[model samples]
Each structure stands twice: as structure tokens, then as C-alpha cells.
Target: AQSVAQPEDQVNVAEGNPLTVKCTYSVSGNPYLFWYVQYPNRGLQFLLKYITGDNLIKGSYGFEAEFNKSQTSFHLKKPSALVSDSALYFCAVRDLTDKLIFGTGTRLQVFP
Candidate 1:
């Protein structure tokens, strides 16, 4: 069984400051992890993905994620955040059946 858990419901950060959104997951076999963002009522947009290699993977909008196999965790990060970066984030894991299991979701609020 594959599942994702985003402990935090929301995260607050200041513009131009670094920000991080934590995520953890459990999956069977090879874990295909992905990060997506939702702006307001819009649908989710792809950010980045981790298929293999390089624990650190870069994504859109100056974002990145670190994949820790031992800990079974993938945490999203950004060196500097912008007001526009405020949105809903979701961490997903693709199961063997090719079904995407999403996390509870994390809402990011970036204050300028």
C-alpha cells in the first residue's frame, strides 16, 4: 500500500526568505514521488519528480526537493520564497498500479 502524509496543514513564510514544506510517504516497490502546486481554485500543476538518483531534485519556480530513501521522506524546499509562491502543495506517490496517492495537502502562505 502507498500513502502520503503532510503533517502540517499550513506553513507561513516571509517573502524573500527561505521556506520549506515537509512531506513523508510509504509505498511498495520503487517509490515514484512527485510534487505539485495549486493556485487558488486552479488544478494542480506539476513541480518536480523523483524517479531515481541524486537525493536533491530541482523543480519549477525555484523550488527543490530532497529524497531520503532511508527515512522514506521527500521534503520540498526553496532558498528564497515570493508572495506568488503562496499556494497549496501536495505530495504524491505513484503506486505499482500507476495510481497516484496524494498527501493531505499543505497550504503555504507567503507574506510580503
Candidate 2:
């Protein structure tokens, strides 16, 4: 069994500031992690994935996440935040059954 946790319910940041949404997972074997963003009442959009290779993985919309195996964490990051970046972010990990188990979601709000 695998599960993801997003401790923050909401993250508020000013424009131009770096932002991060935390995620942690627990799984039996190799873990396949993914990040997705969703606008109001919309479907989740694929951001990035960490299946193998470099620990740091980049994705759409100038987003990146670091895969920390020892910590069992994959925290999403952005160099400089934008007001348009505000959205609901989700983290998911593939379970043994090959199903995506998603987090409760963390709402991000970027203000000018």
C-alpha cells in the first residue's frame, strides 16, 4: 500500500517569491510519484514525474520537484512565484495495484 500526505491545506505567497508544496509518501517497493495542478472545478493536469534518474525533476509551468528517497519526500518548488500560479496542487503515488492514490490537495494562493 502507498499513500501521500499534504500537510498544508493552503499556502499563501506574494508574487515573485518562491513557493513550495510539501508531499511525502510511503510504499513497499519502488515508488512512482507525480505532481498535478487543478484549477477551480477542473481536472488534474500532469506537472512532473519521478520514476527514475536524477533526483531533481522539472515539469510544466516552471515547476520542479526533488525526490528524496531517504526522507520519503517529493516537495514541489518554483524559483519565482506568479499570481497566475495560484491553484490546487495534488501529489500522488502509484500503489501496488497500479492505482493512483492522491492527496487531499493543497490550495496555493499567490497575491500581488
Q: Candidate 1's residue-wise lDDT over 48-102, tens digit each?
A: 9999989999999899999998999999999999999999999999988888999
TM-score: model 2 vs. ground truth = 0.98
List runs of model 1 lying over 4 Å from the truth: none
Q: List the residue pairs that clash in candidate 1.
A: none
TM-score of each: 0.97, 0.98
lDDT of each: 0.95, 0.96
Worst 10 residues of 1 by lDDT: 23-32
Q: RMSD to the native, candidate 2?
A: 0.6
- Residues 34-98 of candidate 2 have per-residue lDDT tens digits of 99999998899999999988999999999999999999999999999999999999999999888
- For lDDT, the strongest prediction is 2
